[model samples]
Target: MQETGVKLSREIVTALVEDATAAPSMHNAQPWKFLFRPSDSVFQVYADLDRAMPHADPTTRALHLGCAAALFNLRVAAAHAGWEPVTRLLPDPADPRLLAEVALAGATAPENDLAPLYPAIHRRHTSRQPFTDEEIPRAVKDALSGAALIEGARLVFPDAWHVQTVLDLVGDAEGRDATEPAAAEELRNWTRVGAGAADAARDGVPDYAFGPRGRHGSAPVRDFAGQQSVPGRGTAVFEGTPQLAVLGTPGDRPKDWLRAGQAMERVLLQATLDGLATSLTSQALERPELRWTVRDPQSAMGFAQMVLRLGYGPSGPGTPRRPVDEVLDIE
Candidate 1:
């Protein structure tokens, strides 16, 4: 009598939420929450404004990016579990904080494309360490761009000129962070320095994952440590020409940001599957003035949401995530 192949259960919701939280965010803040209503088999992804970095994400753009990244992971996890997730962004106009609504309907045919990325969900982490100067194959780049395209966004690999522009803008952002007390304070508030704290931290980037201080090469990696010295942290030379991809959308709105975030995680998961080390930076995008110039002039991408560095190198250690219990509330 049963027509549906899969049914939503509390256990399944728990597992899916766990996989979703593994997505990368600004400072690993994990600015997301999930509320599962088993009665309707719907999962509500909400923006946890408490986790928002006020100074760094004044408009909450980066916060939206992080939440949508988790949303993408949730879709992959659901598809892998043989459930088709019907998702809507900004579903409720009255509630600005509710980022997405995912209704799970049993699937006669699950999303094959998304199910393949399930394994990469937890495997993909923001690698802050130095990447080698190996050129990524054209095929890999095309796949990544295609991934973004399907998510209603564009992933553009910048030309050499645009790459240098990004580096310069990144440097500018750093310089501002150094001089601006608010920016410096925001960075300090989110990063864990001590061994005990970093070890016990449920969220935020830990000192151990900060990678070596950039003595040279100046890869686009954000120096989480800043001026605060980690006792054992050492300096290393990063890749000279960091391969950068700009993930953007035609319009810069809440929905567009959500799409960009989903596209971003899709690209990252694919990159991880392809065995590429990855790290992303919102430093330049943090500052409104610098954010505009991040996009390539010739590219059709209207706005740059995130700058990603991809190459062959260490995949970096896994960062901590808040427990599912802490982030998810079952109804």
Candidate 2:
């Protein structure tokens, strides 16, 4: 694994790509492709436009977020595998879909700070189940915030009133989705229900990962089973006072979204390592007006990129991911 002259081994390259694909995406679309240039030990990330949800994510902000998350994972994986990843976001402005290019340089030391988060990479899941009402410790919260800062973003735990407001906005988005045929169609297109689809398909949110219907709670979890009724899906009461955190960046461009996405995965991995279950709700941020309102004027966080729900609950089952071979191209 020499950084200057030698190409990365096939096994190591495969492992890095596998860890990258494990990142969470909107509806588990896994809208990312990786190209490994063995000649220069460079790994490129590209967005798969075919998998983009045009109706729900018109500007492709969510797509960039997903790809950036994978980019963060690649960095972590490289560190854990004894390489220092030098990443360049949007390396080519002409190709908007080319999100990032990571050049792996062999590290003198095998262990790095990101090595500790390597284990949590596989452990982190989007838990939709209800979390207990217990509050997160201040120290743990601070650590999560630090993780976001390292990735060039801010993570803020809003006050109760702000949390309530964001929850209300989420509810409004959900209500709009119920009547918005385009939104419903977009969700259905990315969600897999039957056993065949859930087990066989490599991407999309499966029926099992949808969690139970929100019988009573204000957790702001997205209900993937919009109108279609599943046979065994039961209703459950979620946490009333969910510990919500907003991740934001100073700007609202493609580069900002990419940084926010990296910050997001860093925070999530850190939280997972700290024994907290987490889920995301970008519903409010999906709408233009609502996205603006989600930002706290009193805080330094400029534009809210994501709303995170954190608490004590099940870690969630693993969702399906595309195989490394399908997503990676080696030259």
Candidate 3:
């Protein structure tokens, strides 16, 4: 990590940020910025409020979740680079926009655990495509739950009835998105179809990543196209029994949201390492009125932060990300 053991170079900083920005965000809205202070080797993460989804994520809970996931990736990158990441979330009360601050210090002991996940950082993508009905192994499921728990969050694999509940909620939310002008407009604004997707520089959900519409069964893939005609988009039958997991924390504060973000990414990365395709949907949790009901009454989890679709199938196409220069600055 320290080529000269004296100062950190700009190239290294940019690379770290590049890995950081690979995190998933609602609508592919990479809503985070990084400031690298070379003097102290500290990177400051801030939420780019402009990239926030106002209609779908009105409270910016999803925005915070995205930023925090980016922050978690930074930690993994730093560890893989042989620098210990010392992170502080919501570092400034005066400036609520400051989501996290990470100091990259030399590690005396190697980060064996985090370094392994660095590879999955690149391999893991949201798989909007249909997955097989094959059940995930018990050991793999346990590992994923452990990953979330390690980051101060809980992952609950709901029963059959609860899975149906989640599917129903997604249907309800999607219907609302159609009827509500604000949500429909926001969805259009965030999606790229036809030429828009092919020439997309960065950000937003490209049509290719939209996956096939679920012709049959209970897959919760969001139709990013809404009603627009994507010339080459195809439709396919999805899994009848889609395996879903709910990631949540006891509290719903900004800090808690940040922790849940880290937990969610860790689970995704671990799942990737274990050879499982994945996707995410929060339509049910996005609507405030329907959020609480998404959580199972029997579960100890409080606020549902994310709903993950996991299985063994084709991983979704990679979405575009803003260039490091566009989102990162050296001070």
Candidate 2 per-residue lDDT over residues 1-331, each given as its tens digit: 2455536888989999999888999999999999988888999999999988877789999988999999999999988877778889999989988999998766725545787889999999999999999999999999999999999999999999999999999999888888999999999988889888888978889999999999998899998988887879999999888899999999999999999999999999999999999999999988997899998778998999999999999988899999899999998
User: Relative to the true structure, how large is the alpha-carbon lDDT of every model?
Assistant: 0.90, 0.90, 0.89
Candidate 3 off by > 4 Å: 1-6
Tens digit of lDDT per residue, candidate 3, span 60-109? 99999999999999999988888778788887899999999988767725
By the TM-score metric, which is better: model 2 or model 3?
A: 2
Model 1, 1-331: lDDT tens digits are: 1133345677778999999999999999999999987667788999999988888899999999999999999999988887887789998999999999988777726325789899999888778888888899999999999999999999999989899999999999888888989988888888999999999999988998999988889688888888897998888999899999999999999999999999999999999999999999788999889999999888898999999999999898999989899999998
List runs of model 1 lying over 4 Å from the truth.
1-6, 108-111
As a TM-score, model 2 comes out at: 0.97
RMSD of 3: 2.3
| Model 2 stretches with alpha carbons more than 4 Å out | 1-3, 108-111
Clashing pairs in 3: none
Return the candidate ranking by lDDT, descending.
2, 1, 3
The TM-scores of all predictions, comma-separated, are: 0.97, 0.97, 0.96
Error of 1 at 120 (Å): 0.6
